[model samples]
Target chain A: MKKVLLSTLLVSLLAACAGQDVKDQPQAAVEDRAAAQTQAGADAKPTGQQSVTANPLKDPSNILSKRSVYYDLDKSDVKAEYKPMVEAHSKYLTSHKDAKVAVQGNTDERGSHEYNIALGNRRADSVKNMMNVYGVPNSQIETVSFGEEKPRATCHDESCWKENRRSDIVYQGE
Target chain B: MIFRKLLVGAAWLLLAPLAHAALTIEIVGSGANQIPISVVPFAGENALPQGITAVIAADLQRSGLFKIVDPAGVRPEPHELAEVNYPDWRTRGADALAVGSALPRSDGKLEVRFRLLDAVKQAQLDAYSYVIDRAQTRATAHKIADLIYEKLTGDVGVFSTRIAYIVKSRSHYELQVADADGYGAQTVLASKEPIISPSWSPNGAKLAYVSFERKKPIIYVQSLVSSQRQVLAQFKGNNSAPAWSPDGKQLAIVLTKDGSSQIYLINADGSGVKRLSYSSGIDTEPSFSPDGAAIIFTSDRGGSPQIYRMSVSGSGAQRLTFEGNYNVSPRFSPDGKSFTFIQRVSGSSFHVALQDLASGQMQVLTDTRMDEAPSFAPNGKMLLYATEIGGRGVLAAVSSDGRVKQRLSTQAGDVREPEWGPLLKN
Candidate 1:
């Protein structure tokens, strides 16, 4: 029972730092896994393993799986660390022109409802603009701002506010 | 961002009241001077449908301006001019005394008579009577309290006004209307989708709000009398933030149909649609001045959301607020001298602020971390808004001068988006 409590506490502590580390740790782990898979010879693959091969969109070991891009308070500017994730999604969209994506803008619950909607729109549009610069057409991207209607964290302090101010990339049929 | 996908299916729960409970107003603070008033038990009150004197006492007590003396069984209940006991109330430290009675009429109605007396002078101040049906006893009690409050304070009382707000419990969202004291709550509309921005019409007959029932936000104007609603604006994309014009002839709404969210003017019956604002960024939350000459709204054209004013025709657009990096939801006072909105300084939270339009001076009214959607009382005595308390949404009110404060909360669920309706015309 004591070990269970300690593990739970440690997991929550790590989850508390997940927002900052989300930009770095997940992509790094994905890269290491991809390199290990390449080091193993392709001819040694077992039978019926083709069905288990991960699709990049649904794969937990790909950068495309990381969707959220965090921002500063009341800011719509995407950070430099999130550029690789956004670039990966842009590349996927450019290769798969038939695919469509929706970018949702969000903000912390700080100001008026309408103002947050505008802020959310700006955040979503910022992601769309970056995708466009990386060769994704406007026709393939739809942007909407949920404002502060949905919150990632229902807290009133800075730690929760930082988690709420973000733009998310959602693919078709997601 | 990943939370958005998870909230899609889990957000809308089965639409039902978590509990059929009435909102109770909690007086968090009060003014320094409290008027001492004694309300002796009304004679023959038990025979009536509702307690007459108890309603009157509660109406006065909730205003945060009057203090009700218990009387403690020391004073006898009196109903007429012949029953006189002025010295009893005077010695009990009551500045004023009220005595009343409820008598049944032959037509199955009730007549309530009340007399206000000056305890020290031992003279009657005023006397009146109201003939009402059994169902109108609560309203009559509020009217009598309004009369007494005006007679003492020389200011129009808001006890007779009504309030409309949105209450959310889990996945169920309800738009509720209640008395100014947070009693007699009636759910006007309920749906599985989110409902927001309840704005009252000029005469308090209808409310224009945005609902997301159809998978997208659409504005609807609902009548309180019939429980019937009309789709005012269901444009191509994102119709929201409906504000009624002063004359009740038009509505200033925000629509993203024109590629970006901009203010538009349409007839109250959803006709003669015309675009009112032409901004590159978002322009929304359009509120009219009391006289209806100009409209005030929040716009991000200046890089950050700020309050901007423009004529009814959408020309002469000028920014009104410049104190902070963030300001939105500007609502003009009834007299059109000042306006209130949410202002964010160099901090992590937003506070409700009052700004004088003539002098461009501002005063922060609340100390809470997050406050929004301020609606002024019809009499211009107080302003109601939504704020967070222990992670739950609740409604709060403060006097226009920022002296007295009160919290109106429910037993369960999150109560928010409070709009104080205008005093209905007789």
Candidate 2:
């Protein structure tokens, strides 16, 4: 009876070892094959495979609909939804020291041209300042004021005016 | 000899009808249709210069209300009103006709005499002669057009007014002044760098533009007559966006010496700098209302770019625009009933829009790709703004009703940032 119990324990141990080897096989293969597959769509293929293996990071449809921060009228505080965009931009600027960007400020055609230009400049400067605080060096950012010179819409209503007053970010140099 | 005798007899017979018809037509206002006018080319005596009649004709056409009969439609008859055959002009649809001749004056100037005759009524509407220097013959023609426009439309004519704008060339930029129709432009200031934001004084005697001289942006007020410039503002951070007050006694500008952009009122002589805005975010672009009681400006304290109205003393700050997400640049119309501004929509395109001050309703003025920098005409009947066409900036004017639109293209370079000054008598 003691000899029979020892043989049963050995058989159970071999079964447990075989199950552990199966689990370890895929991970070890991934590690070993990852280097050789660098030129074979490695990043894209792995990300796709990872999506199937785990939770997806993002929904593809939401990417096109995403917008930068939109502020209240006459305000510049970042909205909660735009925090990610700002953070991403900040992160990129922080990582790339040689990258330079420009922020162009604009206004709707309601006030005097002179006034609008100054207001636009201030808006651009506001964006530049925010970027600076986000670890972007002053030299890596530039600001210009288009004022009421460039409107994105032609409507004479409040709806169009709300869209005209904005600051746009443009990557100048990489 | 027989034709001369018959013409003499006809003139005598037409005198009575001319006198009676003048009283009837001049006293009543029944004609609302096109005046059916013809401006005859002035007879050039002594071979003085080029064609001046075409200039007058073009000026009237630019108004978009005048219907000038083709030169070939009406026959060139005698210069005298009595010599014109009323039936001949009536058949040609020429309700009114202008006949003029220029002669050398004894004072070495030019005497241009013109006569306007009513073809249908067989009467003389007006007859005047101007004594001007030979070089000012074109101006004389414009004056004639002005007179005729006033006689027909019963509104003041803007043919003789000028427009000031910034022109960007390949390597240089200039502040230019030109006729209202964008002809005969002369550069008032040319710099190797950028010259921007041209503003005209109330009296139209001077222009204020921001020049990037001395490696920094400075506001320079230059007299158009004397070509003299005075650096109005050159502060530590930036001294730009100079807006002349209505009374011409002071200028409203944005200065950044106090850590944030704020509106400041300074005397035209560069004295009495009074801060008007005190806010955490930027308060810039201050444009005074027509009545000078209030100012419309752009501020970002509320989180985004939007228009705000405040008293000149910096009180009663209230938000004006709420719709959309972006609105900036607020220019008050001369009548103070409406304002014009730029609005940006999706896809990063911009257009000019007008807002009724009382109703707060807005209307888009342009449908082009990028339309901006809208300013009111002196009469508030139209708006002038900058539009990019074929990658070149051109100045465009749109009627207040948005029906009549005109593109004012400069001879060279990109013309932008137009500022229409008030009518100057001189």
Q: What is the TM-score of chain B alone in each candidate?
A: 0.89, 0.87
Clashes of each: 0, 48
lDDT, residue B117, model 2:
73
After superposition, candidate 2 runs with Cα above 4 Å error: A1-174, B1-35, B76-78
In the range B1-426, model 1's lDDT, one tens digit per residue, is 111121211112212222212212122334557778888777778877668789899888877778898876663466665676877776777877888787788987776777777676666766766667787778777777886676666667777789999898876789999988888999998765568899999988899998766544689999998978889999865788999999999999988776678999999999988999998988988889999999999988998889999999999999989988889899999998889998886675778889998999989988877788998988677899998888898999887778768887754788888899987664
Score chain A of each prediction against the true chain A by TM-score and list the results.
0.71, 0.57
Identify the runs in model 1 with alpha carbons over 4 angstroms from their true place. Answer: A1-55, A94-97, A134-137, B1-33, B120-123
Candidate 2 lDDT, A50-118, residue by residue in tens: 346432112222211121233455455554444444444555556656667666677765544555666
lDDT accuracy of residue B3 in candidate 2: 16
Q: DockQ of each model against the real complex?
A: 0.22, 0.09
- Give the distance in Å from residue B239's predicted Cα in candidate 1 to where it truly belongs: 2.1
